[model samples]
Target chain A: MLEVFGRRPYLVLLVMALLLAPVPFLQLNDYIVHVLTLFLIFAVFATGWNITLGLLGLKTLGHHAFFAIGAYASALVSHYFGVSPWITMWLGALIAAVAGIIIGFPILRIRSMPHVAIVTLAFAEIVRLVFANLKDITRGELGFWGIPPFNPIGIGDTAIRFGLGNAAGSFALAAVLFVGVHLILLLLLRGRCGLTFLAIRDAEAAAESLGVRLAAWKLFAFGISAAVVGLSGAVYAHYLMILTPTSVAGPEMLISLLAMIIVGGVGRFFGPIYGALLLTATSELLRDFGDYRMLLYGALIIVFVFIAPAGIAGLKPRLGRKPAEATKPVEAV
Target chain B: MSSTQFIELVLNGLITGSIYALVGSGIALVYGTTRVLNFAHGELMMLAGYGVLLFSVTLGWPVLLAALATILLVMLLGAIIQRVTIAPLMKREDWAFNVVAVTIGLSIFLQSAAQLIWGEQFQGVPYFFSGVAVIGDVRMPWQRIAILLVALAVMGLCALVLFRTRLGRIIRATAQDAEAALAVGIPSGLVHTAVFSISAALAGTGAILLSPLVTVSPWMGASYLLKGFAVVILGGLGSFGGAVAAGFLLGLIESFSVSFVSSEWSNVVAFVFLIAVIWVRPEGLFAGRGA
Candidate 1:
């Protein structure tokens, strides 16, 4: 069974797609739909983050800075200039990408992992502080509210509307973004640049010896990852219709993204997807635990690090026949 | 600002820097010996603060005794954390990333557990010394002076140990090269445990001193953790004396920034300074041996 599934993984993806295709139309309650929408948005974010963190092997604890920048850029642009989110979102992404390159350039020069983590974390704090202090722009702690939602497009008199005021439209938008980001990442990882990334990650000195421009590729990964995360943040801002420093760029967001990728299996193509679904579902289920929710997350990280460092994606082979053989192809994929 | 006010801020910055130096040194110690950042260092400091609250506030123990007990307890906890979580992962190919994740997990665990145990209320202890010292129109709180004195004394003691004692030599050896230390029969595992304990004890001391200055809460450690990281990086990772010097430098910068600029911008200035340092001089201003 494992062999068959492993050999025909695209079949599994197709089946999963078919299963999820009707979620918005299922007439699920608003709460469930909203939660699903959030899950999808975060899925896009975690997947994008995985490109730099998991694949490129950069340990950043401040990817939320990009996300926050994107949200703020899109919201402010729309609020002041009355630009459509359809246009402003890309602008936000471009801003975030530029910020990423600027931040990643110098820090990536240092080879130390902990140094990278500290610099990135400090960069995020600086961004958050700037946002909070710029009350005229971001409204400080008052928060930027009433962010205009994604407007509907029209064909002559008749209109095709997202109607994101409701959960269904929001869910549809999130799903499209998730699928789009996921495919881009998947294709990127399957190509030659992906091999370059793998080479840099596994052996930087060796990759550099082979004439691979280490600085350029690392910056590219960081920029692309930030752009993708920025896109998700734009969607998130529109859906929520409000943006706060803590809500958008807080340490909790970074932790959640890290937990998703770690729990799913870092470096696996579908790791963030499995991680997002399982973690989001579990957190939702354990909502009654209230204060204990974070405690559970903490425990999950510890347990996964110790018992299943490879995460859920790493568990399939252990449960299958010819476990070692089964693991090889999955890892290669 | 007047010279008196400037002097006061500079003194205050030094006091703050002393605490930061103490905390950063602990983090540096652990990192030096184990090659682990100990993301939970601030959490350990938080735990120690709670320990003081538990003993001195709840049980009404003498402040000094409570502090001594808390420091000792925290040291043991740090050693155990290293032995249990970090030591086991040392052999893994992904030790660096795994250690980071485990420490992050441990940090969250310690924070939430503190909230659970302490009921999320802000806790505090009375000033260790209640008085003020006035020198040439510059008035300073006695507590602040005591903090600086105690931190310097402890750091002096740590320096003496590291330079003058056999265990310190072993630790230094291990930090320099674990395999070489092991080949020389230094028992690198014991050195790791000792380093972690010493680091935690330093954090506890800083926490006990700081508890009187700030409202103690479960989440208080998070900011300190960041500041400690900033100090560590500015000092250059694994450089103890550099961390101490950088701590003072960062403290002065923050103090002046907060006084001249808005309070919120102080953090931004500090972080921006950190990024600037990283970009310009990754080796740190006072690059110590093996930094």
Candidate 2:
């Protein structure tokens, strides 16, 4: 298993998971736990985004749309139909996956990076506008509240309740989802599928010449990535129990995702996860700055690009051989 | 629709299209020369908006002088941003993606800074040409007409400089092949800075003209940036002239759609047209015809 999934990253994942496992039981500060929960959710998001961006070399600027789609779909369905969020979340994921394929089909066909960036960004704008304009359904930018949290699971004489001020269940759910998603990602990247993805990323022409079905693989990457993001979005909806078009679907979300990947280490296995954690903490610290928060984020991106192109993951030379491999230049498509 | 309404929409489309042309061509020029799709192009427009407001409104400068000062200031800023931010990143092997990321950061940074400094209120510039021009059944404001005319003149002058000047030759040569141009002793880096400056100037022009029609605000540039991008893709990725043509086409589509549907859906209609165009011809309408 170590050989298949690569030993070092697996070890890092295990260590991080083990370290974080006892937070809820330890009765840590609720704010700390909340931050951790937010970390896990964003980690899931950045990881899913990493599939298309880092692994597949697709510089998509609009993964936030899928996230919003997932959140809204699950929230709307659960609220309107009186169904449990547990079931609706999966339904949301399915809808987002379909949207992914629909958008990805036209998107992956283009070879120009500028065209791809513009198309994806525009598509996200369309989604945001639709959500904002559909005030009757989404409640628009006024905010969508009263969302039902996850139903508690009865365990013999005890129950794991998930609601406001008690984030233990949400943390647990997020932790499980985070671990499950990473494992799937690891498994996916360890096989022939992984090889095809690498081939396509390194050289599309060469991959196509080698009988790699580019469309199928690209769509697969996009679809799975979108589904994961969507799932996280559903988790977010139930956890936060509130939604706003700008909060979930805005371009700011894209900025956050990009900042995480770029600051952590684009294309690196453990890079974005580390990035998500660091950024979440930094954002909390900058919360007092209010308007200056995004300014600092933008400055952070530029600073990291020039000074620490290899990111935090690169700073750790003890990790393994050739730590800078992920930072290598990808061919501009 | 009535003929007068049709004429009004058409005129509105052309006027808006001219501004879009300026914005898109600026982006196209930079992309053509540098191969970097600047995410902060819109921010430059925003900066110019503030610059004009400061000069004409706060400092009490003449409108023409304020406009000139704003354009030059933005041009200088364009050069500085290229030299400081974009140039250094482009030296790296991961320049393509890094440049995109950095520009996005720069864009957000500028927007936030503007909000912090200028506040969130909308500020307007007085119209440069205030009288109305009546052509039979059509009555158009001279300000709007000036926008269309000035944009045409500016773009025409830009074309002349690009085609007829030595600087234009250097720029064109570099765009064609940077290494070849460098081999022949053309400073490609400097040319890139020049292109960025020119692009900023174009965006600045658009902002100045638009300040009266649309209030100058921090978020004002975001939507135009999106429309400019649609024009870029519809006209061809790096084709300046193509972007100009596509800009007019997009503006027309938008105005006509507003006539049919509500104004809110105009952007959707325009983007749909862009997507359809891309689906049918990924190379865009005027692609492969040279920059």
Candidate 3:
């Protein structure tokens, strides 16, 4: 199984996708489909997060700012102007990208690593506070409701609707988005820009000496990542038909995203997807444990950091190498 | 606002600012010596608040005794956490990321555990000192004045320890260069543990002081954690005196914003100021030795 997966990776991905495609039609309960749909959405969200965190080596606790921006933008446009969500989603992404650039430019220019994390966190808090206080627009803590769903795509008599109002439709939309993002990320990873990002992450000084524009590339990564996350947020708002500060820009969202990437495998192509699926599933299964879910997630992080800092995807390389070689310390960038 | 109102706001800001400095200095001290940002710093404070509640409110101990005992307990927990989670990952190349992840994990663990044990209800202990003091046109609560006085006293003690003593010298050496400190027979590991414990103790003290001002909840640490970082950053990372100065500055900023603008904008203004400060002077306002 490992050999086949290693030799023809696409085959494994295809099989996985094919298996998941029929999940909605399997006559499973609505709760199951709902969870799966959430899994898919977060899979996309986490994947987007990986672009900045794993590949670009940016420590951001503020991606939720972009998520909230996309959510509010989509919701507001649809509600105030009666625009279709399909169009407003892109607008949301664009606005988020701009906001990302605005924020990323200053902090990325001055701060590095851990400082970036705190600054971004502060930025996210600022965004949340602004949204919460802007009662006229965001309705304060009461939140905005009755958001219109994305218009369905279909021929005259055979319309195919999609959104949270219909569980299957939500699943379908999320699945398609997950695949699209996955493909885009895969393609990018195979390109020069992706390699440059990895080089920057591994050794910024060396990459800079090699003529790579560190600031530009970092900002680019930030913008693209924010855009993708914003798109997910836009969809999330429309699907849930409600937008709130807690739902969009809360620490819980940030923690869950961090958990997904850490557990799945940082910098690995399938890490976020795997992490999202496994962690989300674990959380769902542990629903019986009530509030212990967060505790479990926290414990999982601590355990992973100590026992397997490389995460599940990183296990393969450890297994493949000799013990002595594997144990040799690598210099931290 | 009138002159009395202005004086009142400034006084209140100083009280809050002193608390921020007290907490921020602890964080700055730990980072100075260990190079590890304890994201769980606020969680330690929250734990200390709960500790106070348990001792004084539930067990009916004296407030002073409960406060002292809780600080000591949290200090021990901080040292243990450093030993168990942070110490192992210290030698790794990816120390920054690993330390951060571990602390965040520790934070979540503590928060949930607190919730499980203490339940979700917000709890508050009775004020250790009550009544108002009037000075000229200004009226101030004695508890608020106590917060400022205690915070200043602790900070002064911290400064004295860091500047005047042998242990202070060793901690300073470790903060400057760990390898050099170790070569000179200073156990850097022990110093790290000491710093962690001291930091937690400071946060615990702040938590106890703050318990009467705000309801104690598992999630109370979240906001304080951010504000603490803002203070540390504005003061300068690993700079003791810088954190103190920045703490008061941030307090005034927040207090004035709350008074002049909407109360909601106070936090937003602090963060915005933090961002601006970082962008303009990332080294911080005071830029202490070795910063």
Candidate 4:
């Protein structure tokens, strides 16, 4: 039954997923590729969120702040200073990481679930409003268009024009980001570092008592997550060659992240890809319905949360398979 | 700012805070009974606001009728939400936590549905007054005074019903401990529905009151919902009077910030207050009391 990978069923599923997904991306239409591109981008984002939200079990309803931080930082640098988009993306991540520290310092101070989520929500909204109104820097809600083209993945300055290969290159970049984040997460979550994060998730005071520095680690998780999200935002901006507050702000960013996380199952390394695919794909297909599609999509997630609290990936375990009962810190409440 | 402007700003802050209090009370009530944050509670209020707005503007009904109808309808909806979503969650104790995601999802559903139904147009709902009131040199709007006065009245009534009436005692008993209330023959199931219904009704009241002052849009409830969270955290969760006070405190800070700082900084005041409360007092100012 164990074919060749010699791993568990889910692990095999992960291997197969990576092996099979490229088939569709390489063959799909432009629209499908666009959505797949979005899905892969969310894969990186949700994975970033998953490290803290899924693995560490933190609930952040305001992740858009970090995403925006990355977008704005990169966009500003590329637009004003004529810096290469590639260099600016990393800058965005670093700036976003700093913003994450600012948010985490105060957010981690909160004890309860609702309090933390609400505070984070307010924090993100305030930042978004500021971005929308800051006409000089962000260009306000009017947005900044004509971003520099993404330098294709290659050695030297033989820079390939972005979107030139009719969706292949974009999807390739997304796939690379996805794989990079996925591998990073897999490595981190399997080691002593992961266990420490687990301990902190389980019992903060106990983790502190056990000599694990709570603030430093939590800040680390926040910063890393923010950095990844920033990278996704930067990629999104440069790829689309357009950026707007509405595009990056509010629940759209979080919903996609949350949906991917929820659909994929929390705490599983490969869970985010499933979440990204299902939520992103379904919403994309429904967008043609004009308005109510998002409403219906939102309603579907509510139904899913109530019905499949463990999410699609966690479903098998719920049916007597004994899923990892690793201490899930942030209960939905 | 001038002395008159300063006094008016404070007064305006108090008024805005009062509206925040009523909505905050609704959120706190649901949170108190269920211990789950109902993100849809804002959407419920939003729908209720639109209900009144539509009745008054489109159907040409009296404001009172529209307001009452909206409250009752939303209350019914709340009872159904309790029966369907909240009740079933009691089975799997962990499912209660899922309310966070579910309610957020529900809020999104409501917002988008309202947008699809009413479009994104910011529609006006006329106030129940004729014009602005002139307080000597400083001119004050009657809608602002009415909003504050009604908020105070509603808070008073909520206090009276939650503490004074026999049903109020039962509600209080349930809020304290559901099992103990059940042992005393209080129907906990009915209490859940009742509490949810009351919460929705309060939201409806707040929405109806707010609809006239602020233009009704699909996303109007988003800020109110966030502010309500701030008020509950600042005032002390489940402490009705504390919610009342903190709601005004938020408004006062906001108005003053808008006057002194830029309007851009106004939201910063709310966000800072939220972070401050959660940082300073995780349990809020008066969290555990029946009040």
Per-model TM-score versus the true fold: 0.96, 0.96, 0.95, 0.91
- Candidate 2 per-residue lDDT, tens place, B1-291, comes to 999999999999999999999999999999989999998999999999999999998999999999999999999999999999999878777688889989999999999999999899999888888799998799999999999999999999988888889999999999999999999999999999999999999999999999988989998787789888888888888888899998888888888898788887787778777777777788888863455
By lDDT, the candidates rank as: 2, 3, 1, 4
- Per-residue lDDT over A1-333 for candidate 2, one digit per residue giving the tens place of the 0 to 100 score: 221233476677788889878878997788888988999999999988877887788888889999999999999999999999999999988998998888887776698888878888888888888888888898999999989998999889989988556678778888988988898888778778777877888899999998999999999988998999999999999899999989998878988888998788777777788899999999988888888878988998888887777567655553446555434432222
The docking category that best describes candidate 4 is medium
The stretch of ten residues in a row with the least summed lDDT in candidate 4 chain B is B89-98
Estimate, for each residue in B1-291, the C-alpha lDDT of model 3 and write its tens digit: 889988998998999999899889999999888889889998999989888988999999998899889989999999999999899999888889889988998899999999999899988788889799998899888988999999999889888988999989999999999999999999999999999998998999899999988879998777789888888888888898898899999999989998668898889889988888888887888868641
> For residues B14-46, what per-residue lDDT tens digits would candidate 4 score against the true structure?
988887888888888877776767888888878
> Residue B141 of model 3: what lDDT?
83
**Deviation from native of the Cα of residue A263 in model 4, angstroms:** 2.0
Once fitted onto the true fold, the runs of candidate 1 whose alpha carbons sit more than 4 angstroms away are A1-13, A154-165, A321-324, A327-333
User: Which residue segments of model 4 deviate by more than 4 Å?
Assistant: A1-28, A152-159, A163-166, A203-209, A316-333, B285-288
What DockQ does each candidate score versus the true complex, computed on alpha carbons?
Answer: 0.65, 0.60, 0.71, 0.60
Candidate 1's clash total is 0
Best by DockQ: 3
Model 1: how far residue B88 lies from native, Å: 0.9
Compute the lDDT for candidate 1.
0.84
lDDT of 2: 0.86
What is the i-RMS of every prediction?
A: 2.3, 2.4, 1.8, 2.5
Candidate 1's DockQ: 0.65
lDDT of 2 at B291: 51
